[model samples]
Target: MKIMNPSLDISWTHCGDGDDARYGKSVKRKVDRVESDGRKVLLDTNDSAFDFIPTAEPSPGTIEDK
Candidate 1:
């Protein structure tokens, strides 16, 4: 089903490079969020083995560091 209110949210974030720590697996992700059917949710890839985080990508006039 296509999302009615596909809140278009985007951001620049650090992501994992696909490798294990012990087995040299080290990775990270820049999380993002979306709104659909009156509910907020995260945007993620289907290949990840974990859910790191889910949050709003900063909006204009919002607080952020330089």
Candidate 2:
């Protein structure tokens, strides 16, 4: 199904990537929100696994940092 309102809603947050991913296996994620059929949900590949992060290409904003 095609998405209607595709946005990322960050539920919680931490300082930044100043730490490692396995640091207590706890890290903050920049949450993404996706809506469908009047239902809202959080979507973040990082939450799935650090492995997913590799598959993600940097977004425009991230490119600016480089």
Candidate 3:
């Protein structure tokens, strides 16, 4: 997922292998901690393992009518 703010220090990058790109891997870390390039995002931490996806929407969350 792309960082909402470029100024954010969060580290991330594309997968190395093509096959690996289909799915995602998770890393155990604090939200405030510095992330690495290969670490998958935390979609649901409550699962047996941290769940994640390859990509995500730009402005996360629903767009309600004003």
Best by lDDT: 1
- Model 3 poorest ten-residue lDDT run: 57-66
Q: How do the predictions measure up, each by TM-score? A: 0.18, 0.19, 0.18
Checking candidate 1 for backbone clashes, the offending pairs are 15-28, 16-27, 16-28, 19-25, 19-26, 20-24, 20-25, 21-25
- Single out the weakest 10-residue window by summed lDDT for candidate 1: 5-14
Clashing pairs in 3: none
Query: What tens digits encode model 1's per-residue C-alpha lDDT throughout 1-66?
Result: 343332332233233334442342223332445345544354365433333322324344432221
What residue runs in model 1 are displaced by over 4 Å at the alpha carbon? Answer: 1-31, 36-38, 49-66
Clashes of each: 8, 3, 0
Each prediction's whole-model lDDT (CA): 0.36, 0.34, 0.34
Q: Over all chains combined, what TM-score does candidate 3 have?
A: 0.18
Residue-level error in angstroms, candidate 2, position 62: 28
What is the per-residue lDDT of model 3 for residues 13-47, given as tens digits with 9 covering 90 to 100?
33234664535443223232224774433333433
